[model samples]
Target: MSYSYTIQQHVYSFPDLKSVLAKASPFRTGDALSGLAAESNMERVAAQFVLSEIALKDFLNEAFIPYEEDEVTRLIMDTHDNVAFQEISGFTVGGLRNWLLSHEVDSQKLAKIAKALTPEMVAAVSKLMRNQDLISVAQKCEVITQFRNTIGKKGHLSVRLQPNHPTDDLRGVAASIVDGLLYGSGDAVIGINPVTDSVDIVGDQLKMMDEIRQRFDIPTQICVLCHLTTSLELLDKSPVDLVFQSIGGTEKTNASFGINLSMLQEAYEGTLQLNRGTLGNNLMYFETGQGSSLSANAHWGVDQQTCETRAYAVARHFNPLLVNSVVGFIGPEYLYDGKQITRAGLEDHFCGKLMGLPMGMDVCYTNHAEADQDDMDNLLTLLGVAGCNFIMGVPGSDDVMLNYQSTSFHDALYVRKVLNKKPAPEFETWLHNMGILDDTGNRLTIEPSHRLLKNL
Candidate 1:
């Protein structure tokens, strides 16, 4: 249905739910580049106003992408928790926003209603939220997942030790891994985005990391960010803790990445059979970002942010251990500059957490983008305050292979110290035992002769 609202006799109209959502989104380069953003500030405000009055349940009745046309839509519709929705069944999107911000809705209330929320519903409500509103509400919701260690626990934050290398050199990759670990990072996982997708190379990397884990008896997992098929091919030969994939919101977008839901399901089931997890069996790591659908020409006119939330639905279905939004890495074409990038980062984190996925942020930007280290520091601190599950711990905030600037090992230390956060429980204990961190868990002890160094 077409939606319109009048302000001082000027009527602003949107042609459909999808159109309204696109127009209502906070100004970003992606929507504007796609010609889906509102034409004027007043029009944008009007769309947000109209969306607020739209009933929350109206989203349930309308599918942005027809269920028959999209499996993500079918997955959202067919598996939605109708029973849990009863709590807020009759509310409008604006009402849900107000209720979410009220004292009546605590962590438990958010968790209870989490499964009832659809990507569209969350995306619509997110449009009405300020950056602070996104952070505040997200801070109240908790989504914990476990593999070798638990993530997303309250009062604790985690970091994915992204020890990436330009070449698939075991010694070089292992060096970054050791550096990250020494700084009390990598509690989430020691993940490396390999230079190649070769199954043999990735298999060798996994074996090397696993050997390090075994030698140090570390309470963490290891992952080589390769294609799902490559990961599956080497599962028998290597120690794979988490299956990695770069998934998008639309089936076509996923297909562009050489992936489908069934492939993801098979990988999930295949990883589970390995029985490698000591803590829990959450066995997947999926990365998503805004504009991916548009980048792949598969958004079908939906806004990038909404398309991004749909990716969360896919992640939620498998109960993945971590869902990271590599925000700002998509370049200035989608996000434009630091301001837009910060907003998208906060919005993605909020939407993913509300969908009950363990969410992390790769607070990063490319060299050509109109961004710098200060912008990243700001986003990183805000994410810390938002209780983001984890972030990338890259070496010196630069990826020689990927050619991007991300949060560094020192960045993790700063956020943790400034936010008064600790690492995962098991990892915190390991740090203390290794004398890398004090018993109070406040600062790194920097033991020069640390035993883990000998393993190198």
Candidate 2:
């Protein structure tokens, strides 16, 4: 029998219902699970199964019975047991805070305790502690700060060439890349978000990016921000260095983008099967934003910022190479104007960092919104100080296709100069070798290069 589910306007079909059901069972809790359940007509009842809104046996009886015991279910049961152990350990919130402050409890112990406590319990403790103290503890948690090799090994920064054009024109894309490279960007990846959703168009763009990378010998990855399934389909036929998707806070919101955790996992695993990425490199790249959940009516009454952080939890599961919070992209309904946008950007950066994501900020705003480059500059400076992993390098911070202004290639240079940071090691070598940057990493005069000038 065929099973299909619709959430928002997207419909997901399960050709093999039992296999799909079993694969989804492990993630049958948390926002990711709830969001999937809510969108799935076949497993709509599974929405309540999260947090024991319904009993497991009852859920199985109402839903389909699994042939095998789910390891994820067993892990959940084990975590509950651990939570019970922590409750009786006699550490009050104040006591825990004091202990953390005094360094009497190390990060490992704190991490263990954090795992045992519910998210609410942690939030209550967080309320009583200083922000600096919380940040310090967060840094210590192993799960919160992952170092992936795609961008930098560790202690190095990166940037992506987001050369968005209105029509996915190869010349337009190359012009942006040339501009970005001349200004010393493209350490993370030279990725493009094709305006058209046509898989063929996206595939052609990916091929073009690959040809450029090979021709220039630039040490960077490439991505075309198509739907995850579309990207998966093109994996064998194209040079897809990373699988990209935009995920959000709620199931319905994610559905609006035609994404779910299962689909994300499929894309990630498919990339692995192809061995397309560098050895020991992560394959997934995701973009997220505040207000996306509320925009899609999937906020579940939660505040936009908290819901945004919950999206990080989903990102953490996949160990993506890059998880960027497009902080100001959603617009005024959730974050009204520049002040709100700046605050949300900083908060999202902090929250994503604490959750151990290779966090980047889009540092962007739409023309229709009450924002400008000055507002983005303020946030960009702060994020640089906060050790952001990457940022977008578009021409003049303007996306001709998306019609939004973001950080420009010059802006990236400014931030790196101010922070005394360099690009990824490989890309840095390429820049020096090309004479675009000198031995001291200073930008050389591009005017002498007629080829680049001619393009300009």
Candidate 3:
């Protein structure tokens, strides 16, 4: 069946739902590079108009990657809540949008319908939303997850203390961690992206961070951002607080990264057996980004943002402790500039939170991209208001190992201070105990001669 609407005698037709979704998406170079973007701005408007008329259940019947060929699609179909979907069974995409934005809809109401909604449905609705609309609705939906520390509670924010080093230098990485901790970062987790994916290096890094965490008795977790296979190999021999992997939107895309649904489940279960978390057991950490499918030639003709939404389904299935989009890290090919990157960041956070994942963001960009610190400041501030679970806290806002610009220790402090958001509950207590945070837990009071330096 064809979908179309008319404007001033000009009939805009979409051959299929996929085409309609592709054209309706926000302007991004990756979609255009894939030849999936709207031909013109008017066509995009027409597509959005047609999409608004699409019924919510229409997405249930259509599979972008077909149920048989894609495991992600199959998981979506198998896990859908028919009973819960009945609540919105009669809604059009536009009607769902209106209902979502209404004053009556709050965090609890959205949570009830979250599992009933598919990623495509959420993604489709997201395209119809403005930047502020995304933020407003996301601000109302609270999806919290935890491991050793509570995160995603209202009025709280967390930072992944990313102390990445070019050579995986123990002392160098340790110094960065100290900086992050003193700055009241690392309430989320102290995650490191090693120069190599070597299991030995990953294990050693895990041990090093764990030792630091133990000496201070910090209430946060630590992870080495390596392949799930590497994590599994070293899980027992090393202190693996979290299992880390790079996931994507499609079966082929994930396969290109050497992961499948079963492998992910195995990694989840394997990490759970260690039982390392203090306050909770949520301990899988997965990272995703737009353009990953396009980069791997596995997007299957879908727009990059929609494909990104599908990756959220994977993260949601495992009940992950941390699910962050390395949004701008994929570079300008997928998200062309600060404008596009900012849009994608808001959209990812909105869609992920709606799909019931504890969403965070790596508010970052590459040096080659047409973005700078100012753009990041805008995105960070917006995400902070949107109640994003966490953001990356790299030293000096630059990753020596990954060689990209990201949020830093100071950035976290600025957002938290201006927005009146505090760190995770457990971490805030630790900071107060260490005298890094004042009695109110709103301001930091770092001491140069703190005992933490002696250990370092």
lDDT tens per residue, model 3, 1-456: 579889889999998898899999989999999999999999999999999999998998888998889999999999999999998999999999999999999999999999999999999999999999999999998988888999999999999999988898989999999988888999889998888999889888999999999999999999998999999999789999999889998999999999999999999998899999888899988899999999999998889999999999998899899899999998888898999999999999999999999999999999889999999999999999999999999989988888899999999989998999999988898999888888555555555678788847
- Looking at model 2, residue 101 earns an lDDT score of 60
| Candidate 2 lDDT score at position 206 | 88
Q: Write the per-residue lDDT of candidate 1 for residues 1-456, one digit (tens) a residue.
A: 888999999999888898989999989989998999999999999999999999988898889998898988999999889999999989999999999999889899999999999999999999999999999999999999999898999889999998888887889998998888888899988998988889889988999999988998999999999999999998887898999999998888899999999999999999999999998999899999999999999999999999999999999999899899999999999998999999999999999999888999999999888999999999999999999999999999999889999999899988888888999999999988887888655556565677877748
Model 2 clashing-pair count: 3
Q: What's the candidate order when arranged by decreasing lDDT?
A: 3, 1, 2
Estimated TM-score for each candidate: 0.98, 0.73, 0.98
RMSD each, Å: 1.0, 11.3, 1.0
Local distance difference test values of all predictions, in order: 0.92, 0.64, 0.92
| Pairs in steric clash, model 2 | 35-251, 144-356, 145-356
Regions of model 3 farther than 4 Å from truth: 441-445
lDDT of 2 at 96: 48
Clashes of each: 0, 3, 0
